[model samples]
Target: MRILLSILLVLLFVPDWSGEPRLPLLPDAAAFRVEQVVLDRRDPARTKLGGLTYLGGVELHGPGPAFGGFSAMMVEGERFTLLSDGGNIVSFVMGGDWTPRAVRFAALPAGPGRGWHKRERDSESLTRDPATGQLWVGFERANEIWRYAPGFAAAQAHSAPPAMVKWSSNGGAEAMVRLRDGRFVVLAEDRRGSVKGTVRGLAFNSDPVKAPRHGFTFSYRPSRGFKPTDMAELPDGRIAILNRRFAVSSAFTAALTLVPRAAIRPGAVVTGREIARFESPVRHDNFEALAVVREGRDTILWIASDDNQWPAQRSLLLKFRLDI
Candidate 1:
């Protein structure tokens, strides 16, 4: 069956979530630095990729071994926050100069975990309320959602939804976005839907962390051979979802797709239209985090990769102008 094949492929080849688990960080803050990278290693002069125009990017370097399994990220203005599946948090402020400021790192104060093991805190998806600065994180294994105060000061509330109880531990909530219409959408990583090659999705009428008892169901089908990893709300209210695929020859590749706002009604089966692809000569890694922001009249996209703490891989952060 296709589901079996997909899971087998992910277990054997995908490093985004299947790679060696990142160890827990110490009580002291971790440290890291960034180095700029090009859009295309084959040709640094290239600037276009599908609907995206490359601005710049960086490869993150941390002294500690447990530094880069980043699965979700949030961006507001020049500040960025990256969260790893193991509950590690890294924050920094960077501008056009490509220099990082106020670089700080810490672990989540609390999670669905008993503060014992990494699997207990397998956070994969994140969305936030920009107006109130509240953040919501979805944890796998436990199939729970947790809300945090601004700046991740503390955990406010959490819940375990009955709908997500049956989702696989590693595939529970992989992509999430807070829509402008006061709804939150979550996409499972590998939970198949009624339609073949589709994953289950849920729309929360309000904050799922505080009221996770109810939601409407839907489905999302990414491009062939790809699964949703992260999502963001576009400036125009559409949804930008990040899908990733792995191949032995390429290592890791990604697809950025867009789903129209009107197509997400309850029980609907939504398929994203491919807007960009990261493959072949284009520089890419296990990109798992996505964030959209607006600057002046332009909408910008920020993407980050989960290196799985592998020496051969990289913790990459990139920015682009969404020309389309």
Candidate 2:
């Protein structure tokens, strides 16, 4: 009876993977610019876009299979890392000359293997702990969290929040980011029968096993029926959210910016209204990663997509100059 009840509860509120009442796309704002989407899948000597700064190029190798379907990315200054759902890691270093020509790419070790744990493992989101430089990875299907030391040399899995595991795979984490205070914030894929994924802001004390107390919560809404992919906090504390299309309109492209940091909290209620959406002229798929890079006075927003192993899809990295 308990299992049946839980399934019923999820069906009632969780955003149907099947198409349902679609949310209309909100009016477009002007805070972002999508410079280019690179479609080449080959291990390139150099992957260069038309107008953006070269972030370096990477070629990945593996014992069994190299990770494909490249998705999200995280950048700190001249250094950046890329995550592929196929479970591969790539790293790059920027050149000192400061032109697009100066950057160089280097491949890093592969992420922890799928069979390493009991869960049905697939990497979704990646975030670096600011102080420790540890990388936290969110896994789908099996619904687990793993922390890896620098260079993916060793990893330790953590028990998830009790509420999250009880909710089953539907409540598995989607994205994670470390707070200024050293606590980590996690995004739940779905909760209480709404497509709105839950944001969990938790503090990591000396112990890493348990997550206590709710930090913040936010749900996603599709403008003209789009789903949010990932989020990043700006220097001033506002959030920039990446959105992608699913189901009938799964190829739409848009984003939301200017979300005040004060608005995201536990048990706090907020909607897409606090979000200002970005309108781009290109189509996007599973725009699963985002990072903010500042060069002097200008702050650039970096966006990447998960190709889902489809030939029609492209491993795309796009750059936008923030007007705010």
**lDDT values of the candidates?**
0.89, 0.52
Tens digits of per-residue lDDT, candidate 2, 110-217, equal 333423331334667677766777777766665556777775667755555544564446445566665555556555544432334433333243223345333334
Over 1-324, each residue of candidate 1 has an lDDT whose tens digit, in order, gives 999998889778754444465356834655677899999998998989999999999999886776889999999899999999888888889999998889888878888755456678888998999899889999988888999999889999898877899999889999988898788899999999769989999988888877786678899999998999999999898899999999998899999999998898889999999989998889888999999999999999999999988888889999999988
Q: Which regions of candidate 2 are displaced past 4 Å?
A: 1-67, 94-119, 166-171, 192-224, 247-252, 272-280
- The alpha-carbon lDDT assigned to residue 146 of candidate 1 equals 91
lDDT at residue 28 of model 1 (Cα atoms):
66
Q: What lDDT would candidate 2 get against the real structure? A: 0.52
Assess every candidate by TM-score: 0.91, 0.66
**Candidate No. with top TM-score:** 1
| TM-score for predicted model 1 compared with the true structure | 0.91
